[model samples]
Target: MQKSIAVVFDSAGTLLHMYRVAKDMSSGDLLTGVESTDLVARRKGRALIVLHTEPSVILAVDRNMRVIDFIDGHDIAIDISCASVPFSVEEAYDIIKDSDIRVDDILQVVGVVRKHCPEIFYVAAGIIVDRNDHSVPYVLSTGGRLFHDSKETVDRLKGLGVSVFIASGDSRRNLKQLAECMGISMERVYDIATTREKARIILELKDTYDKVLMVGDGMNDILALRAADVGIVTLQQGDHRPEKLEMSADVVIRDIREVLGIVESL
Candidate 1:
């Protein structure tokens, strides 16, 4: 039998909202460990550096920095943990040496991160990085929770014979857990950790499905929405920056259940 329209959903905002963890989400300036005074000096010379560090687990910043790729410090390594990669002291310095990023650029990226992660906190200006190569930052990131009845919505979509896929900036482990909880096939999930990757995945899905619908609620999902045949923005009351999403998506939905109706009509 011919397949119904395929739907791709962004994991963080579209499938689940931000569920608080131990503390509210916050970010702060990157600090230097001993002998690493040069790092802070470099920032002072060029730009103010801000970072979102979740101790022992992750360090994140906006993607525009391009610092994630060049750094190869002993304690620091870059990996696809989020849209932005985390770093340790040496790795962060590696990026600075290779890229020579300016202060204005760092400010711009920090602003974008602040806008998106409102729970973001700016750590103390002079937080010490210390000589400990494995020193973890004090800040911690929050978690995500599925929208009310989200699993039911996926089940309903499958009931209607629609092919459902997940494209998200979240870690593979998180997405895998979500897939298992919702009974979604692991093969159908894509760890699209960047905006460009999300759009690329949508295009790839388009090749297999006659029609593709992309649904999301964050700025990162904008490009993918435009790439799909139909883009739906799921709006929740009191949510941040709904207007931006409304403008980006082809259709604005107030409820996750609305997606089922939208698909049926298509």
Candidate 2:
């Protein structure tokens, strides 16, 4: 059976009201209330690597094994497969090693985060690495609550027979919790997804659904937004939208609930 419509959403800024904090490895400066995409966009050779384990686990590993030493010794490639499931400390070590980043640099950033941001819940921990120089320029930690209208919007979309999927660059562990909270199945979530992967998901969904709609709020969502049948960019996050990002979408909206009306009109 062909589904009438499928809506793909970006998790962080789209459905979650994110509070992001980043540590600049070079200057030892802490940047609060920043956008992750804007940080990545402003720098070159930067790729955001999301860790799929709890912050406590990483802290534990750092205490016993010394995160710097473990990563310095291990030579592994970044494995996206581990993103889909919860990973062990050993797996997390390997994932960090894959970045080919200088372990010492990242450790300092992690240390600063531990000292200053003790109260944050830490929904996601990410490293912004310079792929060319093999150094971590920034380490970021994010915590967010689901938008007030997020779950209701999801329920409303489902009532209208629209399939909802979350495709984001965030960790799967967090996305799983979000899926459960929104009553979306785990199978519909794509975690640690790259920009290309998000677009690919939209393109593939087009084969089974009559139309595909992508709703997102950042530069990272540009590719997927353009690929969908209807690309909707939501400004509910209240962040500054880049001209390029806004131009990529077919429609611009202020709230996620507006999607229900757009879907109905389609």
Best by TM-score: 2
Q: Write the per-residue lDDT of candidate 1 for residues 1-266, one digit (tens) a residue.
A: 56558998887657776532111112444321211112222222211122332322223433343433313222333333222223344443443444433223334333444445554322111122212332222212234567777889999999988899998755555678789988889899986346677888989888888889998876667778899999998875235544665787888988888999889877
Q: What lDDT would each prediction earn against the true structure?
A: 0.56, 0.74
Q: List candidate 2 stretches off by more than 4 Å.
A: 1-3, 61-66, 70-122
lDDT of 2: 0.74
Cα RMSD, each candidate: 11.3, 5.5
